[model samples]
Target: MSVVVLDGSTVRSFVADEAAFSRSVDARFAALDTNGDGVLSRAELRRALESFRLLDGGGFGSTEPPPVPSEVAALYDSVFEQFDADHSGAVDHAEFRDEMRRIMLAVADGLGSQPLQVAVDDQGGSFLLEAAEHEEAMIAARVRKESKKEADGK
Candidate 1:
């Protein structure tokens, strides 16, 4: 399902309170780290995305089901590249926390007074995936509609 995530107040609050934000980020990192490994790999990130049910949805019709696992992995790759700071191929809790703080701060600061709400809700950074999915759906639907008309000799 598509969801709306408002980043202004929530992010601003997190930015304003470093301790609380750290705790919150730590809790999230621990969850995503899984296996108590203290680091998040591509596999871990994929698992986390699946667990959050963030890897799929947005009216994907029967002809075109939600993204396959590889597509999700590709998304994770881009996310990891951006978040992995140290080139360790894995993201530690500290790195995760710092990155989140940076992203939240950017949103809060860059957008100014207006609340920034991204429908993609990918947890961090761009909503490119979400926007692309919606756009593709619209295009697919239009194609299907036109095809049906042609088949009916319209």
Candidate 2:
């Protein structure tokens, strides 16, 4: 038998890779972007969070969703605050993408070369890896922009 283990840095690098992160983000956004609008309204966000609460307790496939838990209800506010980086009360794809990038990169930074192997079971679902070129550029630019903002704010 052969075994291979990836360190935390390796896993972090995999997530930091712009293309890979964005694909995961994209799929998540697609599911959450109800009504086919490019932007996520506050209502859409609240509803999504409500759905998450139900799913968290094995409520999936149920005709009626369970009530939101108190913790998730509180988390809903913080999550929106984080996701809407500009706090404009709405999250467009760019803001959402940039915010996600910033978060993933920050986590990678905090991992700081620690060792942590990764394993995956696809379970037949697919993850799109080849993002549009402009998407890559957008992430890079947003990262730079947020970095500058952080620096300037500090």
Candidate 3:
């Protein structure tokens, strides 16, 4: 059976491509499309942000504030703007899928020679899964430490 080795970014790509992930993203977009107009204007986007804050236990009057990092928020805004092509302030399913495909291809290319493949055999799947699991643990640890530092005012 052909075996494929995947780098950390490739694993992230696969995770993003998962059907469950796609459905979750689609649901979020649908929810953000306020007014039933099938479009998400800037005001709708702002409402979505507020909704997220509320969902995450950070209400409008809460002093705790939201936990999203500045870099992450910037990234989200950039992506949202990019997807809202034509300046119409909305992204249909086609646009969303196109953007997602663009992002996936870019991530895959950045992974270099570490091509993430679907193996034909069980052994190959197991090997790749184990490697990805280890890498995920390492990434999680690093993220946790960084988050702690950010919380500590460091």
Candidate 4:
């Protein structure tokens, strides 16, 4: 695991092993595949959204909620399409792993300047080290300012 610290209080960890990352992706996909139909349909995606909302301390009943935002729906569809490369309308384990690897590589490339390092402790916790580059630091500052402005408006 590698840790990225945004500030004194905000830190996040990322698994270093590609296999571990793939496993995590597989687990999430399995949890969201409500119908066990191999492919994730719109209904399954809705179920995933509702589940995530509940996990984030929101409320959702067994019945599906009203229509989701068009942008959100389109994003979901696009992700599924990308993973289901053969147009099989379903993503097998291998396909899922491959797509996950590609996504991870892209993310790693984006953060190339802030390279990640993994350290294992005695308690078996993986520690992630993330050192922000000049550009990343600037971006973070801008984001913080924008967030503060939004909060003040509220």
The candidate that achieves the highest TM-score relative to the unseen native structure: 1
Alpha-carbon shift of residue 132 in model 4 (angstroms): 15
Ranking by TM-score: 1, 2, 4, 3
What lDDT does each candidate get? 0.66, 0.62, 0.59, 0.54
TM-score of each: 0.57, 0.51, 0.37, 0.45
- The TM-score measured for candidate 2 stands at 0.51
Candidate 1: Cα lDDT at 119? 57
Poorest lDDT segment (10 consecutive residues) of candidate 3:
120-129
Clashing pairs in 2: 8-115, 8-116
Which structure is stronger by lDDT: 2 or 3? 2
- Model 2 Cα lDDT, one tens digit per residue, 87-125: 888899988888766665565465556544333323322
Weakest lDDT window of 10 consecutive positions for candidate 4: 124-133
Highest lDDT among the candidates is held by which one?
A: 1
Q: Residue-wise lDDT of candidate 4 within 1-154, one digit each (tens)?
A: 3334333211222334444455566676776676787766656755654544433322455455544577666766786788777877667767766775676556555545454433423232221222122225557889999999999999
Residue 70 shift from truth in candidate 3, angstroms: 17
Please give, for residues 9-128, the per-residue lDDT of candidate 1 as tens digits.
445654555665566677678777778888998788767656667656555464556778787778878888878899898888778877877876786666565644455545542323
| Over 4 Å off, model 2 | 1-5, 46-71, 118-154
